[model samples]
Target chain A: MDSLTSPVKSAHPEGTAYGTVLDADVALRFSTLDAEYEAIRERAALLDLSGERIIEITGDAASAFAQRVLARDVEYLTAERCMTSLVLAEDGTAVDQVVVWGRETGLLLESSVGGGTRLLEHLKANADAGVEITDRTAEFALFGLEGPYAWGVVGRLIDGELAALPFESVVDTQWDGVDIVFARTGVTGEYGYKVLVPAESAEQLWTKAMEQAVPAGQEAVELAMLEVRQPVMRHEAGEGVDVLEMGAGWLVDITKEEFIGRDAVMAAFEAAAERRTVGFSGGDTVPAAGTPVTVDGEQIGEVVHAVHSIGLGSALGLLRLPPDLAAAGLKLTVGDTEVTTLTSPYVTPKSWSTPII
Target chain B: MTLEDLRAAAALRQQTCAQIKKMIVSRLDLPIEPAWITDDQPLFGRGLELDSLDVLELYVAIEAEFGVALYDSDMSVFGSVSRLADHVNPALAPSA
Candidate 1:
């Protein structure tokens, strides 16, 4: 197969930086990160997320196959409904976080960036009696419209009632003479939607969406993710931690009979999680990743993700700390700076009365 | 139920609504004042725009604060502050 390219890559002008997503080169930014970040928070911003992978699984046993590989229950999912789940290793460590969409034909699994290959292999390894898996990443281009005005832009383009759309639901519709899939999903914690269109029509869709939205890049998306306390896959997963410790136990359905790492997860829960992922603010200096967190000069945890948030106007950091030390208002030291622990999601949406996107 | 009991229950329901509103604002770190959150305002989607994750956090907070065990399937209780008060008020009543 030929190397993949994002349909909207050519639209980004000078000063645009490129980065590898999955195996494709994608535009990281068109303008300054600050400008893009502002667009996504206050107004509408369009992002080309085509670098994320989409895989299709079909056949009689597709749902059963998915149920085994993912941590969430898949038996109840119906057409146009999406469930966010974690693909786990045998030990219950997260391999990737994926959004699985139930379609009429079968199931569509959308992987987080850099997660496609491993997730595909995991699915194939656990394939049931009669299931077929295909890589559909190259066939489709994904774009996201986020921020307070996201729905308005999508409403203007689509004929349907955007207000009726529920969160985590998908709608198959036509836009500008092209077929598209609109999923009411977002990473920014604002009103948001994800648009999936054919690679051939992606440029046209991008052009139309851009008319109403300021073009944003990955860095801005990351800022939004942090403000909302959405965990980064690479930073949240790995040694010394499990999904339950990351405060994502809600994603795991204990009622489900089985899944890839169900046993390990249950055992971890039984053992009781010793540490948890929490957010912190009010630090004069932003701490680097892996910076030690201490209480009274006693080391307790390390910073997993840190950023200077323009939205909050403070340096924010996600830390893995013991439950005793993670309470809101608890003061801890990061390097020489004293920081106060706050709950996850430093930013909250101001209003839900209006259709956000 | 007796008229006196009914009156007491109504007062408890009102108190529950006030408490729930206060807990939501403080626990979720919402910027809105607790007094400003009307009883009938929707808590999810258009009214307050709280997402599923927010629902989970709110559930944990309510359970901790009020000792009311809300099931995941009982999301209708979250339709509005008034509805949540109705669901929780009876539970708060002292056992006969």
Candidate 2:
């Protein structure tokens, strides 16, 4: 793998490849900017996202009603695929982040941490009275494989051709002869898939994905196989951010006949969006997470996540900036350290963190 | 003043059993029960997991129902149905 521009490599490459430990036996690692996995933005790569929580919404009114409540158009999604969306409270604050999938009689909703309980409660209150809501977070394990080669590699794991499957497509099929529910959706900027397998069969599915991608003309998709905690970034960046500032305003459907947070989010959108979530340069010193962002001596927002990007020379951060100052080349202060603002997603898609083989 | 006078005085400032319990069930989203709740059970104990947020919501419901503003010290006064009943009785009573 090679690149014209790449972030500085971590001193301890091996330690960098593997992230902090989740458990004694399960070590996590993240790919660096020069690794082949980063190429996912352009071509393909794989990611493992087993830690994300999944919630299920079933019964008749699940689809139409959820479509009305969520930020994306859920009615248009079919069983074979998925879409990204946010669920906001009436105040426009992000109460829970969710992904909705249409699978047969119901929809599968993968929620953020603590969101499972909230989503379940929300459905119980808002969904049709007869709708059956279940928190299946305990029943299944989830894994993600992303990148351009994501489809090609994942297809090899299942019994049939996977690339032929439509985006957001889901099928109950055998992977290495194990029953699994494979959905074509992902969080990374590339085409990806999320596989839901019984907890008992998780090991088998994971082992199979690790072994199959290379043979399928795709490399193994190591999700956080390294120590890059992206969620931590989002969380640190999330405080100053309301939906409108996160570029997730699409989640707010003001025109919906009626839904939670519709008025609040729309009101916030109209009311100058006090702050905007933007990417910032770490410059010479990386601001600690939650460090306030300032411009011209006035406080704007704060840093959510700051990591030394091996792809970019300086520190890369997800920050919330006041709407007026979130443009490219805008200067801001991260703590006592002064910094410059860059375009959204300060890092390159796909190739930003990983190398293009 | 006599004990009856004390009870009367407390009653004048307290909330009704129906209003308090209704607010609890509605805020907690628990099944409605007309049975009277004695305020002795711990709000954070076994039967409920009322966190700081739940307690705050309960306060909002209490204020709305009884039309009384609760002070910070009043937060400790609510626990079991009995304590809640004792605390709200004076507020629910008709103003002299």
Candidate 3:
């Protein structure tokens, strides 16, 4: 399993910063974090999502297999729709978060950045009769446009009418006469869209899109995602961490009677939750994962992850605390500095207020 | 603050969140259990898939249930269960 690299990496700016996230080497910053972050928060950002692998599941039993594997029910997912779901291990641990794209043939699971190898392995190990999983990464390239004004970019680059399509809407459309799969999906609580174009024309599409929007790197994208509390699976999912503890229960549809990890998830849900995840912000120094969260010098939890939040102008991160202490507006200590447990969406997304015109 | 004090404060916020989640599920006629909704999950478009109509229902339900009039508040109040909890119970919101 070689590490994945962006197909458009050659076209990135000269000073781009690249880093490894799981199995992919991604652009951490194209110019500066501030510039790219501004693009995603204020204007539109062009994202080269080549780090994510696209795996197509097709065959006689594709539907049933997808229903059994995904934490969410996709039984009725038509080719006109797409959705996000968690691929959970049998014990309720998260293998990877994926975007399930409904296609005419079957379904495509777009793995979280750098998470494709593990997700591919998991699907194959569980492969049953009537299922054929194929790695289609070499055939197509995926790119994303996201921001409060990302819809405007869609209007400029593709179709003006497609800008206002319903969220999670999917359409097999065209770009510069090149057939592509377009979807109205977003990660940062913004008006986002994705285009799946042929590998040969990906660089050309990326170049054309770069004209309408700024090329944002992984750092900016992930930061905006954090501000909205979108689960960054690579950062949040840890060993012995269940969906409940990771605060990702919403990704799993517990009512679904049967699925991998259902029993373990149900047991955790039925019994008392030992610990729950909550958001916190404080201090100038970003605390490291495993940093002690204390009250009156008594440790009660640890930092799951943290980073200097450009939006908040301070450290922003998640804390895994006792269920009783997981709520917001509490004064606690994170690695010797007092931090405030705040509500979800530490920063409000502009897309909520902005509309496609 | 002491651990006991923190626990008491967290309990207050958690109680408020539980109430909000229950209200949302009941008013929206959502099929899943109220407890299934996490405190941090988004309430619009993506996570819960609540639309503008759902928001209107929640506004009325919230006014009647929690006695908080959020008609003028921005949509961010409905960003998450915990976020709505802060508005319904301002004591849980960080002091400005």
Tens-digit lDDT string for candidate 1 (A1-357): 343567677766667887865555667787888889888887788888876779999999888888888888888888878877788888888878888888999889988766677777887877888899999987898988887777777788775475348888888888898988878887776778888899888877788877888888877787787776566676667685788677555456656788989999878877745876767886657888899987566788899878888877888878887654444435677888888665334666432334433
Tell me, per candidate, how large a share of the native contacts it keeps: 0.00, 0.00, 0.92
- Flag the better candidate by DockQ, 2 or 3: 3
Task: Score residue A284 of candidate 2 by CA lDDT.
Answer: 65
lDDT digits (tens) for residues A232-257 of candidate 3: 99999989899989989989988788
Worst lDDT run of 10 residues, candidate 1 chain A, spans A348-357
Computed on C-alpha atoms, the DockQ of candidate 1 is 0.04
TM-score of each: 0.79, 0.61, 0.98
Where does candidate 3 stray beyond 4 Å?
Answer: none
> How accurate locally is residue B33 in candidate 1, as Cα lDDT from 0 to 100?
54
Model 2 segments more than 4 A misplaced: A1-48, A125-127, A212-241, A295-298, A350-357, B1-96
Report candidate 1's fraction of native contacts: 0.00
Clashing pairs in 1: A151-A357, A352-B46, A353-B46
Per-residue lDDT for A103-212 in model 2, tens only? 87778888643345555566667667556777675577666666656666665666447654655678887776678887766544355677788877766566666654
Against the native complex, each candidate's DockQ, computed on alpha carbons, is 0.04, 0.01, 0.85
Ranking by TM-score: 3, 1, 2
